[model samples]
Target: MSTSAGQPPYRDAEESVGDLVKHASEQISQLMRQELRLAQAEMRQKGKRFGRGGGLLGGAGVVGFVALLAAVTTAIVALDLVWPLWLSALVVTAALLLLAALLGLVGKKQVGKATPATPEQAIHSIKADVAEIKERARR
Candidate 1:
């Protein structure tokens, strides 16, 4: 029988089945590649955002350190009348050091939690797709 437009030509069942499997495999592979690329792009964007955030946090830490120094100096001048100047400076210096250490620890943890650059999700997706293709082909 003549095939109409938008219709597949009649063929043996085996042939039709093989063609279907081939087409599906090709489409799945294409989709898998696209997904991998998308994952890479997303990871890169996330890395950039994390870097920018880290930079901002570092800047804030520097500003805070400077402010702490200024405050300590001012307090030492004003309190020298009632307290030992050396004691005031020591206390302020210790507090500023502790604050710096705490900020460093927090920033380290934040950066550690950021998403990895590897396309793990895409890798998993492609693996699953391959298994499905294999299973279908076997049938």
Candidate 2:
């Protein structure tokens, strides 16, 4: 007998218990693999965010050091000469400090965003899937 046009050949009117169990196993395995992939992608994204935050923080530190040096130079120049050069150095130092502050704030925000970097969505999905499986099994 030929199956209907809308149906596949393997999906008959009735399936054996073993076939059902095997299909369920395959489905569960596929689900696990998908969850794993999701978790890995999430972790990689979090890692990148963390790396960006760390780089920004390092830049802030370097800028802060430059600002310190500029301040010291400004003081020394002000003592040596009575001109606008000291004032210019002071302005540069202020600008560097502002830039460093901005970088530090942005880096802190990035790090905060990436904190507790767990695969939250994947975990929720897996939990929901398990709950659904349990509910179905009760029937």
Candidate 3:
């Protein structure tokens, strides 16, 4: 269809069809690029959140480790007054090792859970849009 009052005769159907196909292709490519950008942004956001969470967790773990060491030192000092120093030290070492192992396990689990925090909603939205576009094109 003519877009302006003084436009020439309308193009042939074949030319129009080619133009429509080209426009559709361009639109689809633009849409795909937009979707990719959205995905990248979402991934970067999720990465930042995970990085912050990981840093906090690491700090907490360090604090816990230091606290455990202090507790072990105090326990060994108190026990040494009543028992042999070597036995008290041995007991404190074993307790500290056990606490360290448990803390490590908990930290590992927390880190594992922090992965893939970005929601699948964006992907689903893109899929829905693609389906709708396909249906419209078919019609």
Candidate 4:
């Protein structure tokens, strides 16, 4: 059946105060469920961002580590030659410094991605919901 004049279907003289309260309760419950779903979606998106940021940082750390290994390996290989110990130390130190500078930049970028993992959509949606509720209450 169709609702009359935009009135709720459950409203009628035969319906007691208890019925009205129950109807309101049911509507509130439905609204809460919808809001929860919205929050879940927003949190999921935020979580993905956080995970991606972590993965990028992990990658940066691994690359930096490999660079260190490479520096050490190069130094060790040079040791077998006629190179002096001081020369080998200098080579490894220079390589380490270069790697640190490059990797530091990349790692900073990856860390920047992970910042402020707040659920923006959820916050906006909740704010809207609160505003709407307030507006309706004023009426």
Candidate 5:
């Protein structure tokens, strides 16, 4: 049977059930592939960001360690000029301990705020697509 010019022949209500099912299966497969590609691309982008961030943090740690060493040395030397060497060393040690404790507390608080890391954007997109498909299917 022929269909109107505005309608596709394959989409006609009179189309065979097997043809309709096959068409739907193909569409679903295409949608799944698209979603998978999106997720892969998203993950790859996130991986790059994580790699760069880790490298930057590592560099910062080295720089901070060197700076901390110099600062401690300066503190001890400056104190020793006015006080005994042993007392200067003790004071510097106490100050470093206090600074470390403060940093530990702040780091703990920040860590508490961290979410269970996942590909949140990809998950959300996939969920939305599923919801849309479900809504359409309901029709």
Candidate 6:
């Protein structure tokens, strides 16, 4: 009788019961290690995306301040043609605030999309694998 590993497992035509069980155990261990590495890599990638999105928000703050100042100055200058000087300033300020509100809502939406970057895919895969193994064991 040939005892070579090339022979299929869990069959009298090949390995003993012990050899088959050991092979299955080793395979399972290797699979788990691979899954863990996948999860780590996924989380690392998500972390980078989150960091980039967050950094963009910070940069947007500085740029937004400059933009506000420019808009106010330009609006007051342009609208002064028809309105009193103080009234022009007030009108420009109100318009600028409304524009800022719109932009703020859009920015908030974009930032919200990139947060809480968990290893969701890996977690789902792990759950599925566990369920399959459990079902097989029951059989």
| Best lDDT among the predictions, by candidate number | 5
lDDT of 3 by residue, 1-139 (tens): 5546664455632456668889989998998888888888888888898789889989998998799779878998999999999999998888878977997999799779876666476798799889999899799
Runs off by more than 4 Å, candidate 1: 1-15, 115-139
lDDT, model 4, position 68: 71
In model 5, the worst 10-residue window by lDDT is 111-120
> Model 1 over residues 2-65: C-alpha lDDT tens digits?
6677567756324677787788878987887797787888789878987898899899989987
**How much lDDT does candidate 3 score?**
0.83
lDDT score of residue 14 within candidate 1: 40
For residue 58, give model 6's deviation from the true position in Å: 3.5
Q: Which stretches of candidate 2 lie over 4 Å from their true place?
A: 1-12, 69-115
Error of 2 at 121 (Å): 1.4
**Tens digits of per-residue lDDT for model 2, 1-139:** 6779877666776686789999989999999999999999988997898789889979997998899787777675764576477676666667777978998999799779866868998999999999999998899
Q: What is the C-alpha RMSD of each candidate to the true structure, in Å?
A: 5.6, 8.4, 4.9, 7.2, 4.9, 5.4
List model 6 lDDT by residue over 1-139, tens digit each: 5556775544745778788789878978987898899999999997798789889979998998899789789889988999999999999878877988998999899769867667888889889988987897797
Q: List the residue pairs that clash in candidate 5.
A: none
Worst 10 residues of 4 by lDDT: 8-17
TM-score of each: 0.64, 0.59, 0.68, 0.52, 0.77, 0.67
- Between candidates 5 and 6, name the one with more favorable lDDT: 5
Cα misplacement distance, residue 72 of candidate 3 (Å): 1.7
For residue 39, what is the lDDT in candidate 5? 80
Order the numbered candidates by TM-score, best leading.
Answer: 5, 3, 6, 1, 2, 4
lDDT of each: 0.79, 0.83, 0.83, 0.79, 0.86, 0.84
Predicted structure 2: lDDT:
0.83
Please provide, for model 4 over 1-139, each residue's C-alpha lDDT reduced to its tens digit, 9 standing for 90 to 100.
Answer: 8888997776754686788679877887887788788888888887887789889989997998899788687776777486777777777788778978997899799779867766677778778877887797687
